[model samples]
Target: MTKDIHLYTASTMNGWKPVIFLEEAGVEYDLTHIDFAKKQHKHPEYLQLNPNGRIPTIVDRSNNDFVVFESGAILWYLAEKYQKFLPQKPDERSVTLQWLMFQMGGIGPMMGQAMYFQRIAAKQGEENLFATDRYVQESRRLMEVLNARLAKSRFLACGEYTIADMATYPWARAFYWAKVQVEDLQHLNRWFDEIDARKATQRALTIPKPFWAFFGKGNVEVQERENADRFKSDVISRSNI
Candidate 1:
């Protein structure tokens, strides 16, 4: 018997990672879109499920007890529990973990800050160009690392598509989706194109479209406006000036 997995996610890169993995692994799961507009992720109910108040949380309906959060942890759980899309060899497994950690620690956060400064920062015009360039350069360097790694191997680890690929693809894809130039990273571009061609990735892109539509054509603009407003309100509340 197949178990039911309940996935709570938004359409952001991190959120899409597990959705794509679940589809690619042919796992049976139900998706629930956590609307970022209304701050659904921070709601009392969701906090009970994930104290961090983040999306991409999952519940195992089979055992009616298992709960998991964080995209990396989710990938690890699905791979271990299903025993699919993960290498059995200890060394390859360790390498896979390395790339996944690289994505989480290096690429994701840097790109996130890049997006913030480019799209949402209130005093962004006054911000140091060096700071902006710093993040952009770091993101580019990480892409170079991935490109060089991919040139030697078909995937980030083990020379085969695995959870490591699933973990990194979404964030790397974000560079393109955000219209960031990556023409120089040829190998990474090739790998990105390969993942984009997958049926599962295509399907994951369309999941919960209606939920995203509420924020407009793309949630990026809407999210920026909301964040800006929130920041302004916070400034006013904190300062007696």
Candidate 2:
């Protein structure tokens, strides 16, 4: 099987995870932007590749066009396929999976909700101060967890850079946008700086274009207008199912 892959992704944190793995693994892959604004993710053709209709699904052409969805699962799949970021020793492998799960279950959801409340709901004038503060606090607490972990170890798991770090870095880097400060989390800050300086991360952040930087800098008013209609349509469509 060849290393050829086709990635359908966007510029969101979850979307960047697998791309970071692919870049670090030095694998050949083509990318197609999953345009949320256009609702292309819900298209039947794309839905077949990922029944959940989420961004960052990958089709492994080398392995008989095997399809993988969910960002964490994609990372695991690639790691096993190439024997790259995953550890071989059983104990270290367990440690890697543990931290990967920590990001999947803890960091991603909390920070994502923080982003929604701060950047979306609040800005849309549907501000829920309680919800915003709740998520932001939880997100900061998770950062503290990572900060403390890093104080003892260089990487998140396996005593080396692993998929766990790849899975978490995108979300961690966006802590500012989530309104969850990492400035006080000195160890976490140091970890972020190291990953941010990597050449693979530099290239990974650009796959499908950088959000919160270039393409994401588009007019907020127009995006809000479009998103309102798109979300309403999505709700109606889901209700029928």
Candidate 3:
């Protein structure tokens, strides 16, 4: 019997994390590009799979038909199902889950805010400076915490290359691209360099598009402006703000 997994994701930081995990775990899966540019995520079909209407949802066609959304949940599901990128011992598994949750709850959201305020909010002008600084500082603090943890262990948890690393690396990559310096966080820089050299990660980063298309875009000012206006009209129009 053959296993089938269908992945629907864009090429954002969160979207790439599961791709990296799948590649690293040597899982054969079908990739479907959800056209985020065309607002395809909000369509009824995609929303059925992910009520949040987000990218990086997966359908496990191998088993009795299971659907998983949220990048962290997808990673955990794959790791547990494959029984490859996870630990066996109870304590080790606990540690791995801890770091995985840390990435999901701490680093990912903070850095997302940082990216939002730095790149997206820049279009709205410097009036959003406080928001930018707040997130940037929080992101840097989380990076430092990871740096301290990595200084003591080879990987994020259990001293092995586990899902914790996979969960955290994409956000670290985004942080690097955002030019939020982590030179002082030597341990993190080292791990970042290691992840940068992985074949799985390299493939994940460039998946769904060519290298040029992924990075060779101009400033997103126009797109951000349009999205902001649309969001305000669609979301805020129904509420008192």
Predicted structure with the largest TM-score when compared to the true one? 2
Highest lDDT against the true fold, candidate = 2
Q: List the candidate numbers ranked by lDDT, top first.
A: 2, 3, 1
Task: Give the range where candidate 2 is weakest over 10 consecutive residues by summed lDDT.
Answer: 212-221
For all predicted structures, in order, the TM-scores are 0.85, 0.88, 0.86
Model 1 lDDT per residue over 148-176, tens place: 99989888987788888888887777774
How many clashing residue pairs are found in candidate 2?
0
Q: Write the per-residue lDDT of candidate 3 for residues 54-163, one digit (tens) a residue.
A: 98999998776689999989988999888977899999998998999999999888888776555544543433677777888888889899999988988899668998
**Candidate 3 displacement at residue 67 in angstroms:** 0.4
What lDDT is reached at residue 66 by model 3?
88
Better of 2 and 3 by TM-score: 2
Task: Kindly report which residue stretches of model 3 are placed more than 4 angstroms away from their true locations once superposed.
Answer: 1-3, 210-241
Report backbone clashes per prediction.
0, 0, 0
Report lDDT (CA) for all predictions: 0.77, 0.84, 0.78
Between candidates 2 and 3, which one is better according to lDDT? Answer: 2
